[model samples]
Target: MNTVQEAKRYLDNAREILREKAHKEEGYYLDTKYVKMAGHTAYVGVLVALDGLLGKKGKGRKGVDWYNQQLSGLDKRPLRSFVGAYDTLHLSMSYDGNPLASVAAAGLAEAETIIKWVESRTVEA
Candidate 1:
């Protein structure tokens, strides 16, 4: 499959994990482990979509700095979305394991935005 498909699968898997395993109670998830897993999974999906559009820098390994730099040069709008994804998906959910349902919702929405933006660009190219 293409990068868009692959990236979307990652996101789908993340949603499934949250829906099936995270054990949501009202507006929060009870399982921090599952939350972390889903966050990491979704964040990776964002990276995959971005990489598909940006290509690899081939500077040993990639990091947030590299991604932000490339995206900032390309377009500031998507750059903001990506930064939000990193903060919400990567840091808040993945590391801190924030249990707020709204946090996850916002993060997931941001991931979707980045992936769709990448898809639009790739399809146009």
Candidate 2:
């Protein structure tokens, strides 16, 4: 729960950055990517909390495997798909060559969606 609170703070900061970037005509694009990643990280934090709330955090494999297992049961297809897409984008952008502008934009959108989902789920959790 404390970890969730901290993650929520970070998520709030990411949203603030995104709101600022949205106001800019041509903002710092990479910062937008960072915001997306930050948002995803926050989502992960929320998942951990929710899993604990639901008593499913340690029921499966550890780490991302456990995360994926929980994600597999979600009823929200769009959110699940966006999370999968962002997972791919995060790996690509972190380890491979630079991502295209469109990829970054897509990642940002996915991150934003995930953040919104986290916000709603956290309340329910």
Candidate 3:
């Protein structure tokens, strides 16, 4: 599969995991493990989308820090979304046992938005 296809696959996988595994009926996730897993999964999807975008510009795969730096120079909306995912979903869960449901939900939404934005800029393999 191509870059976009790969990114979409990751995004879809993250969405499924978030909906099925990370979801909680109490309005917030109680399972720290699932929260961390979901965050990591969604973060991976964001990275894949970033790779797709950078690859299109003749850039090779880079670290998360590099991606963040690049994102800082791009559109503010997606950059904000990316930052939210990175901060709340990707990193914050490690230190917090019970992350708020709104935070996780927002992270997922941001990731999905980033994936969609990347998809819009890419073509099928």
Of the pair 1 and 3, which is ahead by lDDT?
A: 1
Top TM-score model:
1
Residue 112 of model 3: what lDDT? 82
- Which lDDT tens digits does candidate 1 get at residues 1-125? 99999999999999999999999999999999999999999999999999899897876889999999999999999999999999999999999999998999999999999999999999899
lDDT of each: 0.95, 0.50, 0.72
**Model 1: CA > 4 A from native:** none
Cα lDDT of model 3 by residue, 24-74, tens digit: 767876567777777777678788778868754446647666777777777
Full ranking by lDDT:
1, 3, 2
lDDT of 2 by residue, 1-125 (tens): 45456545654654565456533234334444554554454445445444443354445545655555566677555447545544644454333322344554555455555545655666786
Off by over 4 Å in 3: 56-61, 94-97, 123-125
* Worst 10 contiguous positions by lDDT, candidate 2: 92-101
Off by over 4 Å in 2: 1-56, 59-61
Per-residue error (Å), model 2, residue 26: 11
RMSD of each: 0.7, 5.3, 3.5
Q: What is the lDDT of residue 2 in candidate 2?
A: 57
